[model samples]
Each structure stands twice: as C-alpha cells, then as structure tokens.
Target: MPNALIIGASRGLGHEFVRQLAGQGWKVFATARNDAALEELRGVGAHACKLDVARPESLAGLGWQLDGESFDLAIYVAGVFGPREGAKSAPTRQDFDLVMHTNVLGAMQALLLVAPMVEAAKGKLVFISSDMASIADASSSYGWIYRSSKAALNMAVRSAASDYPGATFAVLSPGWVRTDMGGENAPLEASESVAGMLDVIAGLKPEESGAYRNYAGKTMPW
Candidate 1:
C-alpha cells in the first residue's frame, strides 16, 4: 500500500480526500490545524499531524516529525477565504495576512517541506488549485484574493515541475464542489470531486508534467 500525506484534512475536500484514500488502502498522514477535528480520522488508517501551514515554526516542527517517513503522494488543501461582506474596506490586517499567507505561502511551504519525500519515492504532488486562476478562461472578474492566490499557486507548481523532472507535479481545479468553502450552490459533491481527481491522478504519466487541469482530467488553460 502507498503512503499518502494530505494537509488541511479536517474538513471540506481535505477531509474527503483522507477518507477516500484510506478506503483505497493507503496509509494516510493527515494534517489539520485542529488536532481535535483530526481525531475523527482515528482508527480510519490515518495518522494525524496538527499544523498551521503559514507558520514557519509549525511547519518546521512538521518537518522534524517526518524526518524518517517517506510518502508516495502528498496533497495540499490548506487555504483561506477571500473578503466576506463587511470585512472589505477596513479589512483587518489579520484577514489580509491570512488570505495570502494561507492560500499562497502556506501551500508552498508545505510542498517544499515534503518535496524531498515525494522526490525520493517518485511520488505525486497534487495541489487543490482553482479554475479561477486561469487567465485564459477569465470571462468574468471575481474573487480577488482566492483567485489571485490560486493563480500564483499554478505558477509555483509549474516552476516546481520544472525543477523535479522525475516526479509528478499537477495543479488541478477541483471544480465547484459543495463544501463549506464552495458553498451550497456548487455543482459537484465532495465525493464526486475527489473521486474524479483521484482518477486523474491515477492516470497521469511522467510525459504529462507541468499541465494545469481540472478534476476530471481535462486540460485547463493557464
């Protein structure tokens, strides 16, 4: 069985990823900010790690903890929300700080930290990016923070892909899934989104690196 690491595994797509991967016989290393929320995965073939990905010290701790373990797949779902109603004009520094830090920097931090393990095993790194990042599909301008941060993530994934020739690095837009983050009106369910993505990942060949795509394995324009 392959070992998989999923960050931000407490809820939303992250939680579902852990569940589905576990059911498929993977030994999962699950990370969530709340150690308690991760408790739900107990006895579910997951080992929990608490991490606030944006914090250097916390991520350093995670690195230390994983010193000897190697994983075949690493998925990142840790991110933050954009401007919500009244929090605009006078947006607290914390809000702005969190939006960029979590969505952009935290993801890079997590990927960088685990790159060695993924590289050693010739594993895959799947980023839960958004379709909002595609400038090619930008017919409407919306969701500033989330969109821009995901755009940045696509670039970073491209760069990382170039740097690691032997590993699989993919940026996938999970589609409009019905999660707390995706809202009630989103078209896809959590299970649908993750299952489709897993199928895509399963079929990825080394020849197809540095591509920006969606959950269903369709090529997406960057």
Candidate 2:
C-alpha cells in the first residue's frame, strides 16, 4: 500500500482525506491537535499523531518520531481563518500574526522537516492553498489576512519545488467548500471537494511541479 501523511486531520477536509485514503488501503499518518479526533482517525486505520503546526518544537519532535520513514504523499492541511470580518483598515496585529503563523509558517516548517522524507520516497508534496490567494483572480477584499497567508504559502512551495526535484510539488485550492471555515452555505460539500482533489492528485505529474490548480484539476492563475 502507498503511504500518506496528512497534517491537521482533526476535522473538515483533513479528516475526509484521512478517511478516504485509509479506505483506499493507504498507510496513512494523520495528525491532529485533539486527542479524541486523533483516536477517531486511528479507528479509521490511520497512524494518528498529535500536531500543533504553529509550534516549531512540535514539528521538530514529529520529525524525530518519523525518522527513517518515508511517505508517498504528504499533504499540509493545517490552517486558520482568522478574523472573518474584513476590515477597511487592516487586521489587528494579533490576528495577522495568528493567521500567518498557522497558515504560512506552519506549512513552511513542515516542508523543511518533510522534504527529505519526500525526496527519499520520490513522492509528492501538496500544500492546500486558497483561490483567494490569487492576485489575478482577486475582486473582493474579504479575508485579506487569510488571502495573503495562502499567497505566501504558494510562493514558498514554488521556491521549494526546485530544491526537491525528485518529488512533485503543487499548491491546490479546495474551493469554497462547506466546511466549518467555509461556512454552511458554501455550495460544495467536504466529500465532494476532497474527492475531486484526490482525482487531481492522482493525475499529478512531476513535470507539473509548482502549478496551482483547483479541486476540479483546472489550473489557476498564480
């Protein structure tokens, strides 16, 4: 069975990825901050671990724990939608810091630790970015902090792509799915979004490294 690691599998899209991958017979390493949720993922045949993406020490410990093991697929799904209300001025410093730490720094730190593992397996690395990160596609001003964080994440992955040529790297936008972050009124369901992303992931080629694509496999402007 192929091996996969999903960060932030406590709920929503991350949890769905764990469930589906385990169902498909993959050896999954799922992480979540909540012990109960980690246990739930464990019940689904995943090797669940506790993770707090915002902490460097936590990531360092995880790297030690997984030493010598490699994964065929590594997906970073940890993020926070900070301060939902868009402001005309700017998000408070606290909100900006929290969002950037969880969304951008966490992904970068995870990549630093996982890059060698990915190179060892010659697999793929995927960062779950957002469509709102696109400067070209921007028309609204909402979620500016969330938007900027993802944009930084995209840039981070693109820069790391060349560093790990053995592995395919891509940033994916899951679309406005009906997750807790996306809200109940969002048109796409969690399962539907995850399923489409899985299809897109299955078809990813090494040549397509650094590409920004949506759940439907359509390329998005950087």
Candidate 3:
C-alpha cells in the first residue's frame, strides 16, 4: 500500500480525501489542529496527528516525528476564506493577515518541511489551490485576499517544483464543491471533486510537475 500524508484533515476537502484514500487501501497519515477533529479523522482509519500548519514550531515537531518515513503522496490542504467582502471592501488587518498566513505561508512552510520525504519516495506533492488564483483567467473582482493568497501559493508551488525535481509537484482546483468553504449553493459535491482528483493523482507523471490542473486533470491557467 502507498503511504500518504494529508495536511489539514479536520474537515471539508481534507476530510474527504482521508475517507476516500483510506477506503481505497492507502496507508494514510492525516493531520488536524485539534483532538476532536483528529479523532474524527481516525474514525475513517487514518493515523491522525495534530498540526497547525501556520506555525513553524508545529512543522518542526512534525518533521522530527516523521523523521524516517516516506510518503507516496503529500498534500497541503489547509486554507481559509477571508473577509467574504469583495475587492471593493477593505478588510480588517486581522482578517487579511489570517488569510495570507494560513493559505500562503502555511502551505509553503508545510511543503518545505515535507519535501524531503516526498522526494525520497519520488511521490507527488499536491497543493489544494484555487481557480480564483488564476491571474490569466480572472473575471471577477472579489475575494482579493483569498485570491492573492492562493495566487502566491500557486507560484510558490510552481517554484518549488523546479527546485525539487525528484518530486512531482502540482496545484489543483477542486471546483465549486458543496463544502463549508464552497457553501450550500455550490454545485458539485465533495465526493465528486475528490474522486476526480484521486483519478488525476493516480495518473500523475513526473513531467506534469509545475502544472496547475483541475480535478478532472485538465490544465488550468497559472
């Protein structure tokens, strides 16, 4: 069985990934920020750990704890939707900081810490990015903070791919799935989005590194 590590498996897309991957016989190590959530993840048969991706100390501890383990897949799935008010409205400093620190810095930090393990296994490193991050496809003037964070995330992952040639690194847009972040009005369900992503992951190639792709494995603009 392939060993997989999923960061931020407390809920939503992260939790769904744990559920599906475990069902498919992958040996999954999942992380959440709290014990209750970790327990919930454990319920789905994933080995759960506590992690606050934005914190350097937490990442350091995690790196130490998993010292010799190698993972076939490692995904950074933690993010925040900050200040729903669009580009027109100015967000408080706290909300803006929260979004950037959690999405961009947090993901980058996690990837840097785990890259060695992923590379050792010649595995895939996936960052859960967003279509909103697409500078080449921007049509809306909303969620600038969230948009900017994910945009930075995409760039960071793309840059990391060049540095970590042994690992297949890519960003994925999970579509408007009906999760807590996507809201009730969103069209697609979490299952559908995760299933598509699993299919894409199953067929990942080293040559596909640095690409921004959708859940269906189609390339998206960076």
Candidate 4:
C-alpha cells in the first residue's frame, strides 16, 4: 500500500483528504490538533498524530514519530484564512502574525522535515494553495492578507523544489469550495474539489515539479 501523510487533518479539506485516501486503501498518517479529531481520524483507519502547525514546538516530535518511514505522498494543508478586509484596511499585528505563521511559516517548517521523507520515496509533495494568490489574475483585494501569504508560500515551494530533485512539488488551488473558510455560498463541494485534485495529482509528471495548477488540472498563473 502507498503511504501518505497529511498535515492538518482536523477538518475541512484536510480531513476530507484523509477520508478519501484511507478509503482508497492508502496507509495514511494524519496530524490534527485535538484528541477528538485524532480519534475521528483513527476511526477511519488513519494513523493520527497530535499537531498544531501554528506551534513550532508541537511539530518537533513529528520527525521521531515517523522515523524510517517513507511516504509516497505528503501534503501540507494547514492554513488559516484571516481577516476578509481589503487593501484599504490594514490587518492588525495579531491577525497578520496568526495568518502568516499558520499559512506560511508552518508550511516552511513542515517542509524541512517532511520533504525528505517524500524525497526518500521519490514521492509527491503538495501544498494546498489558492487561486487568489495569482498575481496576474488578481481582480480583487479581498482577503489580501491570505492571498499574500499564499503567494509567499508558492514562492517558498517553488524555490525549494530545486533542492529536492527526488520529489515532485505542486502548488494547487482548490477553488472556491464550500468549506468553513469558503462559506456556504461557494460554488463547489469539498468532495468534488478533493476528487478533482487527486486526479490532478495522479497525473502529475516529474518534469512538472513546482507547477501551479487548479484542482481541475488547469495550469494556473503564479
């Protein structure tokens, strides 16, 4: 069975990834912040670990827990959508810190540890990004902070891809899915979004490493 690791498997898209991957007979190792979520993951046959991506100290034990394990896929899905304010309104320091730390710094830290395992197995490393991060397609300033963070994340992943030649790195946009962050008015469902993304992932070629694409497999502008 192929081994996969999902960071931030507590709820929303992250949790859905765990369910779908496990249901497909993948040996999934998932990380969540609380016991309840961890138990839920375990109930679905996933190996669950306690993790809060915002807290660096919490991620310290991950290396030891998965030592000697090689993952066929590793995904960093932990992120926070901060204030919905536009450019006219600046985000507070607390909001900036919370958003950037969870969405950007946390992924960077996790990549330092998880990328090696994916590389060891010559697997794929995916980061769940947003189309709002596209600089060329920017039509709105809404959620500017979130957009900026994701853009930074894209750069981080793109830059790091060269260092991990054994692994394929992809920055994917899940589109406007109806999740806790996307709200009920969103156009797509989590299941549909995840399924589309999985198909895209399955078809990714080694030469396409560091490419940015949507869940539907369309190449997206950076």
> Judged by lDDT, which candidate is best?
4
Question: Which lDDT tens digits does candidate 2 get at residues 1-222?
Answer: 899999999999999999899889999998988889988998888998888998999998888778788989999999999876665866899999999999999999999898789878989899999989998998887888998899999999999999899889999999999999999999999999999999999899999998899999999998
Q: In order, what lDDT does every prediction score?
A: 0.84, 0.91, 0.91, 0.95
Q: For model 1, what is the error of residue 178's alpha carbon versus the real structure, in angstroms, after optimal superposition?
A: 0.5
Candidates in order, TM-scores: namely 0.93, 0.98, 0.97, 0.99
Q: After superposition, how far is residue 203 of candidate 1 from its true place, in Å?
A: 0.9
Query: How well does model 2 score by local distance difference test?
Result: 0.91
Mark the regions of model 1 whose C-alpha exceeds 4 Å error after superposition: 84-93
Residue 169 displacement (Å), model 4: 0.3
Query: RMSD, model 1, all Cα superposed?
Result: 2.1
Best to worst by lDDT, what's the order?
A: 4, 2, 3, 1
Which runs in model 4 stand beyond 4 Å of their true positions?
A: none
Which candidate wins on TM-score? 4
Summarize candidate 3's per-residue lDDT along 1-222 as a digit string, tens digits: 999999989999999999999999999999999999989998999999888987889988888778799999998899999877787898899998899999999888888888889999999999999889999999986888899999999999998898999899989999999988999999999999999998998788999898899998889987
Model 2: weakest 10-residue lDDT segment is 82-91
Runs off by more than 4 Å, candidate 3: none
| Candidate 2: clashing pairs of residues | none
Q: In model 1, what is the error at residue 93, expressed in angstroms?
A: 5.0
- Ranking the candidates on TM-score from highest down gives 4, 2, 3, 1
